[model samples]
Target: MNKTLQTDLLEIESLLELVKKQGIEYLNKIDERKTSANVHKAELINLDSKGLGARNTLQLFNETFEPTIVSSSGPRFWGYVIGGSTPASIMGDWLATIYDQNPQAINGEGDISANIELETIQLILDLFNLPKSFVGGFVTGATMSNFTCLAVARQWFGKNYGKDFAKEGITEKINVLTATPHSSALKSLALLGIGSNNIIKVNTIEGNREAISIDDLESKIKTLNGQPFILISSAGTVNTVDFDNFNAIKKLKKKYNFWWHTDAAFGGFAACSDTYNHFVKDWGHSDSITIDCHKWLNVPYESAVFLIKEEHSSLQVESFQNSNAPYLGNPMENFNYLNFLPENSRRLKALPAWFSLRAYGKEGYKNIVENAIDLAKYFGSKIKESENFKLLAPVRLNNIVFNISNNRNKENIDSFLTQLNKTGKVFMTPTLYNDQKGIRVSFVNWRTTKNDIELVFKEMNRIINIIE
Candidate 1:
């Protein structure tokens, strides 16, 4: 054996000793960083440090690595509609990385991966009461999810209208109708040859579309004058926690033959709760839906779900979608996952979502969703009781859109947000609801306790009192 290659017993023992000691210590060091509150900030380290040994890397990790592991997992992180990750999900994520399963397309890896993805998709379909035949795929987050769904919509429309959007591209005359609160991803969809300027911004009631009166939708559709239409609705809007009038919009979809897409990135999963199911009820009929498992499901970063009303919607978009090389695509030809998504190689992030759903069961998910909704209501009620605060809209789903004061202008409104963020007692975001600036809070974390909301109010009162 070569001198360096043939492991001498002494050298092997030394290597093992280094690995065991350093590995154990490094893991403990990471764990400490995760469980601590000092993670509101972090430092960086040089990857190419000559002086750093294994001990030094561990030391550097200790000195630098700070976890963004949000208190969302803890009882006080009431910032966004983010879910605290479950232990089972974390373990599944680890296994996925170790195995490094890349199920971006269909036929790259083990059946277990694709099947896990299919099964997860099935569960979501069942959860949403969608058709069993609907096709679904795992994506990064809502943005990609929205892009995937809208891309399918574009493909479907282009195919139906005899336009080669996949090759010759959009006719430069296609139009998409959406609301003001439509997620920013819509802008990206517009960039995907859908034409941002072509989008017709409908007036919405409240922050969501549940209040979108049928009259407004009818009037808007009537004005279209035979233009191609792709109607986008929200299952749960980010601001105002409003769900677009899906029931009302469904009627227009059938009448106008428009591809109805729902961007329920954060809110779509809320259907897990019976109380909130009405928000996304009848979603089955929608041509496409975009959902995020990482938000309410608490899986991990970049776990997005895209569902299509018909099978092979992904395949239809295949003109622009990825196709595997003969060497890679031909052998394991049972199913090639790459055909569906824009990416060829992607992390098997679905495993964690599958594992999480299996571990939690439907009831477990329902309970968690219910808990978050209830907490939001509880917080909304608390805010309502305070004279210093104002309720901007009805507490619907899990978002509380309210203003700290009745001051309704551009200058004071901007000042209020800056003050609140600077205080850092609570991190809140502002939105435009009914053409007015409203502060919104999302109760997404399972760790968020009732006491946390109380803390938020106390802090808000302190800040408002000082500023007022």
Candidate 2:
């Protein structure tokens, strides 16, 4: 080993202790941390021939880069459906790095990380009140989760016409139908060789809603002329958090030959609340589903799950199987994640979720979900009452889509959002809804509270007055 590496290894205990102390301090002061950093320029550093060692490197990082780190995980950050990590989740994430176990095989030569992953999947299924007939695995995020599910959906579509797209390549035009899909799902289509433009847009429900219209959806299916297609449905839309009528979709599955997939990333948390469970009623009937642990489970980044029905396991293997490598063994004989999902090598991505689930249980998550929904409603009420702002859609769950009250303020939406984010007390993202400029504020962080709502309301008003 190099001299510097050996010296660093000798001081690993003290180095880790220093990091732990810093982590605790940062997390404790997160509420006061700025949610945005205006400074975009940084001094680029070159690698040194002689190492600085861990201690001096830490000092250098603190001096040069740490100040630029914005508190996206903080309570006031209501941008892009982000969520903060729970205490238990952070603990598990730290351990995952320390262990550095690659979770790929169920009965491998040595590691059993895959077993832990399987257990975590079961825990998630139970939390959502889903049936055991679905087999799930962890992926990087909702994008990859959607890709995994749709890959199998693609294979299944090919099977309906006596073809194996995975083996022979896509020789036919794949039919896809959707209404109000998250951008990530469409990106997945692009990655899966299913052209994003190929999606047949199903009309949404009449009035100010993003949910799919059952009557329109049925009419669209009739146009397919008994062709097998893939229906990508949203359990929670990004703009207004609108959920499709899953009960009605379940009824259509009986008559139509199509693979149903729901992108329930953050919205799936509705299952935790009796008051909100209706949003995803009968969603378990979906052939596949995507849920992000980082968004609503309050786990760290790069965490999501893709669940495909057990009956389609063969199709999944056919889509993702590493058949060329004989060393990986038969894809079907010995159960392995390498043949089940996109990635062949993966970390113990399920550990943090496992820790969070075991630490909080169902009641704790229920409280977290309900608290976020309450905060969103509170914030939405404030927006509705404000003279300068108006809601673009009703507060359906945990997202508030709003805009400036009148046409005069329309042109200022982008500038208003920029100024507000520059305030550093809060952060929000600009969006377009129904061809009108708007801003989206999503509440999924467990630390968010009524006090945070009050703080944000005051900040929003202050920013609006200054902008006007």
Each candidate's lDDT (Cα)? Answer: 0.68, 0.91
Write model 2 residue lDDT over 387-418, tens digit each, in one string: 88999999989999999888346777888889
Tell me how far candidate 2 lies from the true structure as C-alpha RMSD in angstroms.
1.6
- lDDT per residue (tens digit) for residues 30-82 in model 1: 31322223434534745663344444454555555523332334444445556
In model 2, the Cα lDDT at residue 281 comes to: 97
User: Clashes in model 2: which pairs?
Assistant: none
Return the TM-score for candidate 1, rounded to 2 decimals: 0.83
After superposition, which runs of candidate 2 have C-alpha atoms over 4 Å from their true positions? 42-45, 326-333
Task: Find the candidate with the highest TM-score and give its number.
Answer: 2
Model 2, residue 41: what's the lDDT?
81
Alpha-carbon TM-score of each model against the true structure: 0.83, 0.97
Ten residues in a row with the worst lDDT in model 2?
A: 325-334
Error of 2 at 64 (Å): 1.3
- Residue 280 CA error for candidate 2 (Å)? 0.9
Give the root-mean-square deviation of each candidate in angstroms: 5.1, 1.6
Model 1 has a clash total of: 9
